[model samples]
Target: MTEQQYNECVNLYSDNVYRFIVKNLRHQEDARDIVQSAFEKMWRHRESVEFDKSKSYLFTVAYNQMIDHLRKVKRINLQEDFTETTKGVQHQQTPQVKKALMEALNRLNETQRSLVMLKDYEGYNYEEIGRITGLNESQVKVYLHRARIALRNYLVSPENVI
Candidate 1:
């Protein structure tokens, strides 16, 4: 990609990329850093990256970076500590249902959570989500189906809503 094409890619995809990272990480600073790193990676490989594939390339990079960061910080273990986190959130003034929803989201493993976020929040189709996540389309469909069922079960549980 030429410099102008790279610039256009950045302008066109930055917000979507950032939002995807932010939804996964929930830390604005860390999300910003990950997004910046993805763009940098794209820039470094600009000569080989085609303009048509720039958006997917950016997302795939950002997703990988976010996974690496989560692994580095051991945030994946947070799923095991969900009860403690939810206890604290319960004491906050946020609405009960929203808090429960967030707690439910936190309970998901990183891959499942990413699948839901990319599909539901970001409107990525199965093929696109698979491309970003390195899953096959069929695998993406199965995992996403399971994640939604998990979310629905969490939301509908009497203990969660109250």
Candidate 2:
């Protein structure tokens, strides 16, 4: 990719990559670092990166870095719901409902939640999501199906309703 292509790549995909990372991590600073690192890696390899696949490349790099970051942090806390959005800001939707769905989403394992975000939230196709998450397309489909089931079960459970 030329310098112009690289700049265009950054402009086009930076927010998307950043949002993906931030939603998974739920930590703005760490997400920012990981996103920047992904971009830097892409920058370093721009010569070999196809301009058309830059979106995939950026997302793949960002996803891997996020998994690495999670492993490194060894965070054990999962009790907190996914209540916050960008930069520690809480969602101001229907007060009771806001927490319920997020709670269900947070109940998912890391891989499952990320898959849900990539497919349902980020609008990635199975093949694209598989590339980004290092899973096969079939695996992506299965995991995503299971994740949605889990979300549905959680949301419909009487104890979880707002």
Using alpha carbons, what is the TM-score of model 2? 0.89
- Candidate 1 ranges beyond 4 A from true positions: 77-97
Please, what is the TM-score per model?
0.83, 0.89
TM-score of model 1 vs. true structure: 0.83
lDDT digits (tens) for residues 46-78 of candidate 1: 999999999999999999999999888876543
Error of 1 at 18 (Å): 1.0
User: What is the alpha-carbon lDDT of model 1 when measured against the actual structure?
Assistant: 0.84
Error of 1 at 32 (Å): 1.1
- Which of the numbered candidates is closest to the native, going by highest lDDT? 2
Worst 10 residues of 1 by lDDT: 79-88
* Model 2, position 1: C-alpha lDDT score: 97
